[model samples]
Target: MPFRPDPSLPVPPAGADPLPLQGLTLLLVDDSRFTCDALRLILHRAGARLRRAESLEIARLHLNCYRPDLAIIDLGLPDGRGEDLIAELSQMGFAVLGISGDPAGRDPALDAGAAAFLEKPLGSVAGLVRLIRQLTTGIGPVAKGEEVPVPAGDPMALRDDLARAARLILAPGDPAYARGFVQSLARASGDASLEAAVRDSGTPFDRARVARMIEDRLNRLRALA
Candidate 1:
């Protein structure tokens, strides 16, 4: 029997048929710990095994040892654009899926050879399961009657992302990269105020202001913790 995921189990118990993605293996390339945590929960519930890479360098290292059935890459990374890695993975015969907060990234990601593109705030577990099935087998989505459960948001993971973004903002290197990282995280986590702040923060003075905002956000996350 195929294995389906049971969210209550840390790892699903053996001997029962699970969801459609039971035997599938996936690689996720993203820098946000919160994003990773969210995807991990979703994939876990679908009985898919997932491995994560936080940067291009780490992803390359993972690729050296093994190739997964699908590679889900975030458009932005701490090291470089995920488009480059997606193109390379596609050339290597891997089914590549690109994800990003910006809808504008969809065409570029597809042009880079991704088999499909998913926009972020990846909250829908059932939608994800159906999409994986379609991408891998050319089969249509599962029946609409199935009850799909959404994963609960991890506040601690969100806090970690906020803290990391704050640190990057205050750091001395690549101001553009820092700003972009914050913007990406803000959009991915559905923080419109933060996203707007980071988007408008082009100058050094503006970035400083955004940095302060990030710090404040981080503090708020901590208070809730």
Candidate 2:
């Protein structure tokens, strides 16, 4: 008779198999540590390995040595616009996906040769899993009927988001450089008041408004902390 199975080995939970992304690897490019944390958990559950880079410069460094199967880039990186990086990655043959809170940024991301665009606050784990499968493997999403976990909203992360935006606001020159990042930061952090405050921060003569916004938001963030 054939060798029988071992009776005491461990087993994965139900619906854990059929992982469509079994051999795929992904890179997440975003400045928000919290956003990365959330996405990391989602991708892991989907059976895909994740690599992270917080800025364009760092992402370039990662690209020099390792190539992921897919790259999901956030438009608002600290060093540069992710659209610019997408062009280079597209040229290198990576299946690239772009994500942003600003609709305007989405078009530029696509123009730079991203495979597709995903709106921010990615929200649900099931939606993300399905999206990656559809974008990378051209296969229907697996585990459609299974339970999908939700990512937690981290207050500390939200505070960091405000801190980063405050730095950009205080620095002179053009706030436009960080406008997209700040807006996305507010949205993901669930701070609607701060979002409205940064609305015109990129325009000249709005320094007072921006400054006031930052101060107010900082107070709230500190309390949350």
Candidate 3:
């Protein structure tokens, strides 16, 4: 049975903690009515303005009507490949996050320039929030030359930054930033294999190892601070 989302429902509470996406409009692209409903609930709970689309064609229609700050796109859609939509949205300057049931399906989305890849039944709402915050706030212009210098001091902050960067690799609309973020993390962590993997796979070279290394590097940097 298809779940019909109540479009007339009032927005959820703002909550005690400040909503990261407060005041931002989000476009959610998915074929399933249930998925759209769930995501709308999440976004509504966070106080974000929500627009739902069931297919690429509908998404395009919504985009023409409203310019969203961010777009959450499902990899499979009835009209066409969602990767194509990601590319189109990137040109239009919308932040794109690709969500897929099959994690392996993330590859083409990443390649197409999605800002992040979120495997569905999205695990950590906080992580998604954090990634959104980072996307809205932390991203900067890509450095022109090779050998960009790591930001000085506060290893914990650096690690957090790197973690955000790792997540950004899956974002479909910002490949240049994603590439730079991965490269910077590799240089900061001084991990040869990590660097190699990032170069080879558009995804993080080794996620677990990179996480541990990020922790270790942050600790080392913190001891000095």
Candidate 4:
């Protein structure tokens, strides 16, 4: 089940904007009413204009009518996978976060096109707030102004290679193959933080676990893109 906020928690002050989220519009895609209600309450309190859809069909309708700066999508939907939507939205210039109760297929989701991934039993609301802020405003520690030195190979060639690797791992397929593909890309990306985390966690390679790792990589790529 999707996580819900505690009702007893203090509510936002009347007429006061939720810090860091004011003036933002968000799209939420999920099949669960409870999930939408819980997220809507939090997002609304943060002063976001929230648009919601319970299926991809409905979400497409909203997308046609509204252009949201950010989207929070659940991986499982009655009609289709959220990762598919992520690819579509990312291409359209919207930042996306994929939330799932079962992280089982997360790796493929990230490969398919999520900017970030969050597991169910949600943790600190502060973290979500911070992530959204960084994604939308490009105002986080990771948003350093320093440029990434171009690699030795042709930039387009490298990008195509990376994209192919991502597709091999993220497209719907056998779980074992997807896990290996992501691990290979993570190593090739030369992201020390991600490599270190993967080493420390030592979790068995699976879609969900790999998705979390790939999501981090995707965020870095998005920054560079």
For each candidate, the alpha-carbon lDDT, in order, equals 0.79, 0.73, 0.62, 0.60
**What tens digits encode model 4's per-residue C-alpha lDDT throughout 1-225?**
223433443454344334457788888886544445556555654556777787899999888887888888877665677889988988887888888755565796688777888765344445666677778888763222222222222234335444544555446655443433333334444445644443343334543454465555555556776
Clashes of each: 6, 0, 9, 4
Please give, for residues 10-68, the per-residue lDDT of candidate 1 as tens digits.
Answer: 43325323566878888889888787877777677666888888899999998888878
**Candidate 3 similarity to native, TM-score:** 0.54
A best-first ranking of the candidates according to their TM-score comes to: 1, 2, 4, 3
Candidate 2 per-residue lDDT over residues 113-164, each given as its tens digit: 9988977666566667777888888887766654444465456766676677
Better of 3 and 4 by lDDT: 3
Best by lDDT: 1
Candidate with better lDDT, 1 vs 3: 1
| TM-scores for the candidates | 0.87, 0.81, 0.54, 0.55
Which of candidates 1 and 4 is the stronger one according to TM-score? 1
Per-residue CA lDDT of model 3 for 99-198, tens digit only, reads 8755565888888889888875564444555566567567432222222222132345455555565455564555644444454345434556655655
Rank by lDDT, highest first: 1, 2, 3, 4
Best by TM-score: 1
Clashes by residue pair, model 2: none
Candidate 4 positional error at 168, Å = 32
